[model samples]
Target: MYKEPIFLKPVFKDRIWGGTKLREEFGYDIPTETTGECWGISAHSHGPSEVINGPLKGKTLDQVWDKHRELFADQEGEDFPLLVKILDAKTDLSVQVHPDDSYAREVEGEAFGKTECWYVINCEPGAELVYGHHANSKLQFEQMVAENRWDELLRKVSIKPGDFVYVPNGTIHAIGAGTMILETQQSSDVTYRVYDYDRRDDAGNPRELHIEKSIEVAMIPHVDADFEPVLSGNEDLRMKKLVRENYFTVYHWNLAGSVSKIENPAYLLVSVLDGEGELKVEGETSSSFKKGDHFILPSTIKNFAMNGNARFIVSHPTI
Candidate 1:
């Protein structure tokens, strides 16, 4: 049997902190207050995911996890490598931090640490994000979290479209309201959420906060970014490298015409950003996709081709 790619329709995650209706793809429920993000594809461990396309098409992401176990965090000693998600922020997210590989190994007994990057897809007026902190120690951060002095302790940065922010493991961060962010990260969803503005969940209960773990794992002494991906071209088809590391190499490929001969890579994740196109992979029937469509291509695809003009973000492991 020839294996085709997998297209995942992400399950909706309603939060006290989301805003995106997640239009175009998932028919996710919207809230009355409208202060939450529409998370597509990958989400926290709180909920499972909906697989919407490709070979693993129409299957839950967790079903795949139970069967293969090598495509996610590999907690059972498999080789699953990364996690990717789209964030639609209608309100500010809680301040939080993630553990690094060493910390995760020693403290949490996890397979890998969390490191991620965000690419701004949409930004409303005055939109911003919390990238890191100004503090030099855990004590100062704890005090800030306690006193609700986020503005003082956090390094708030204004954002616009075409901006990219890298959040390495242990970096204190949060996504602000009115911004849509595409996040690519290590497969594990072990986040240490520190603060949540006293918001309650749908059950009207205060959500959990991992303050002690957050403080212990949060990065201090901010690392300034002197690096940005070079814009490669500006044709009907455009390719911009978002981030390249051992974990993954992501590229923004825009198109209006047919793109041919892409069949080999360890794995490829195609997220349609705009327009529409028909894709032929693994000798199966071609599939049509438009804005917000996505598929996970296996390493065995041969003679793959795309018909029509459509823009998509592609991600694959660097190895």
Candidate 2:
């Protein structure tokens, strides 16, 4: 059983639509000027995070999941259920859609789908995203695509800092340019691109578009769900419940001084988004943390206290 917090090293990915905001904001040693994503907490094959501290140090999260079941409260699963990422969109991302769990299992042989939520960290003035589509039916979606009527078929929404957007699977969406967001989602990498702005890669080849797959999975008649965050806390800490869905529950924690509580979930995934703090697993060990730090509080450490002024995006997988 693990008795300490497991800090993970993020894996960065360079994308065509990426930019230097990751370095400018988080102080990450980005691999390229176009570094787009920091896979902060992940166990997917595409980008598994490695434990940077504790006894599990140097072990990839995938290895720990496969070898040490006790660390995750003995949760039985073939793979980790959640992924956390920070995306910097210097240019618009491809308009895309993802399949549901049933579709993913049957068609892609994957264990999870891609229902995701984005916490808008920061964005330039007037930044907008493709939130959903206007197509009333699959046939109409196809017809619009065939006619290249993007203006009439896509629905765009303006966003700003601290805004939360829940994106369910089958929602046709895209991240617009000059936006940065912290994303929490089911651990899946399946994306079906519907549009790419006719942009070509370095090889001078236009990126692939999965028109059939996108139409097969996109929700007919997009409907945005109403998510009003519930707020509660004391003088020292304020908690905003972002969303509680089938796959995971996410929250934003703002700390002014200190707070103590019992760790109740199977495991807690935490990303320090602002300020600095120290976490003490009561009677065990304590560590200092600051912005851009990511760690998992395993089930083994039940009671803990955190002190300092900071903000964190905390989440846990749902059974």
Candidate 3:
């Protein structure tokens, strides 16, 4: 059994709404100037992360999940349950919605629905995004879209760095321009686009919109899903319980000194957001980590110790 942290190599994604900030801020060797996303900790078929260290080095995350099921405590899922990403939106994203589990399993034939949450990393001053709609019914929603009454239909909200937003399936939303976020999401990637600002590709073709499917999946009379994040920790280590949904639980770890004896029965997905640190398991040598590093603390590790100043976004599947 592997008892060390499984470090991962991130996979970059290019997007029309992307910019060079991913390279400028995180110092990533981005593939293009318009690199929009870093799939930091993912096992989705489209962009699975590769193991960069340990005996599993060179293996894709999906391969580990298949061959070494014990690494995850043998969690019961046909596919990896979570995906972690950092998205840099140079311009506004398409107004989109995702289907729930039942719809995804039946229609898209996917293992999971795309319910995701965002931790705002940085945003331009006075940044705002489309959160929901003011439509009272499906008919009214269709009417507003048909009329091109975007201002009246979309509900925008101001946002800033350090803010967190939970976007479940069927939530109509878009990431605004000049914004960056660390997103924790289900492994599925089924998005139904409602609007795209009439954008066109390099070939001069308008991007396709799933108007009917978007309408079918979007929540009528949008309801805000309320969450109460809890905080706990000692003086040197602070932990904020960001969200504990049916699929996964996420946390923000702020460390200044050291924490020994940290343990979790299940595996952990960890992404270092800032600063540097060293992690040491009971018998293994210490491993140094810094900003933009992502790794998995497998169940076989049992416990570990972390030292130094660092901030981390950590999550685990709900097994």
Candidate 4:
């Protein structure tokens, strides 16, 4: 009977490399200039998003997932399987890597790992990011780290807006300065930092580096994820399948006008990137959204239609 979209209030996080672009670009009432992240659609304990509409108003996404499982089609998982975030990197983030599901559960005692994909929202000219490493073996990787041969060991790639990059578990990566992106990933927050550019904290203490764990999990001779983004639809509404993997399936929805009715078999995590739109659920005038808005379409509401000009990043956990 829950027919409306579940809008969630974003929970912002402060970081050393953060900036105010999140507010400037998205019109968010950010808490600080150093706000680096907006956890848009999340259920993780660290920063769960709260429901902003309907009967679930004021409840955190985790509560709705736990108490009202049918909203997500009774998805099988102890924790919500995915998280959606928007990041503003005013400066380079720490070069880091994340563990896979097995390592996360066995060592961190967590339900999931952090395999994520990024859709570049905007970036500065000549923007480049650490994507992987040049090391061909663990011995070489350890030696490079030991010798501080950063320039020789790290692999960098140029990026631009509208580009999609997939960072699988164990992939060493970093988000460079003056860049903004939307990230979708497993609902985990365990990051093993390898390098921090010799940066110090506000207290004048050097940031800690998880060298050992990073070395243990780092993929020797980094492998790139190979996949093609399939584009579909027409001038009115162009739907691009950005990714379809074991964990989740993501799409970039570009709407210039009205779109025909669509059915949702499972719940959907949606983030409006730009422009404005109205969503009609089962022909019910339920919700309207704009740029920077994030919400969920519960499984109970099977059909919906869209009207207006806007772009959205949409995803659903692969069940």
For candidate 4, write residues 210-280 as lDDT tens digits.
99999888888999998889999888889999988889899999999998687796999999999997999
- What ranking of all candidate models by lDDT puts the best one first? 4, 3, 2, 1
CA-RMSD of model 4 = 0.8
Candidate 2 has which clashing residue pairs, if any? none
The alpha-carbon deviation from the true structure for residue 112 of candidate 2, after best TM-score superposition, in angstroms, is: 1.1
Q: Each prediction's Cα lDDT score? A: 0.70, 0.92, 0.93, 0.94
Tens digits of lDDT, candidate 1, 1-319: 3455577765555566665456523344545444244334442354445676545655665567567544432335343556667777777788788898888888887767888888888788888888888887777777878888877888989999878887888888899887877787876667898777788887999889998898788776667654567577445456788778767788888776766666455667677766887878754668777777656665555557677787677787677
Error of 3 at 310 (Å): 0.8
Backbone clashes in model 3, listed as residue pairs:
none
User: Which lDDT tens digits does candidate 3 get at residues 105-147?
Assistant: 9999998888999999899999988899999999999999999
Candidate order by decreasing TM-score:
4, 3, 2, 1
What does candidate 2's lDDT look like per residue over 60-156, in tens digits? Answer: 9999999987888888889999999999999999999999999999999999889999999999999999999898888898999999999999999
- For model 4, the stretches where C-alpha displacement exceeds 4 angstroms are none
Clashes of 2: 0
How far is 315's C-alpha from truth in model 1 (Å)? 0.9
Which of 1 and 3 is ahead in lDDT? 3
**Model 4 lDDT-worst window of ten:** 258-267
TM-score of each: 0.82, 0.98, 0.98, 0.99
**Clash number for every model?**
11, 0, 0, 0
Model 4 residue 112 distance off true place after TM-score fit, in angstroms:
0.8
Residue 1 in model 4: lDDT: 87
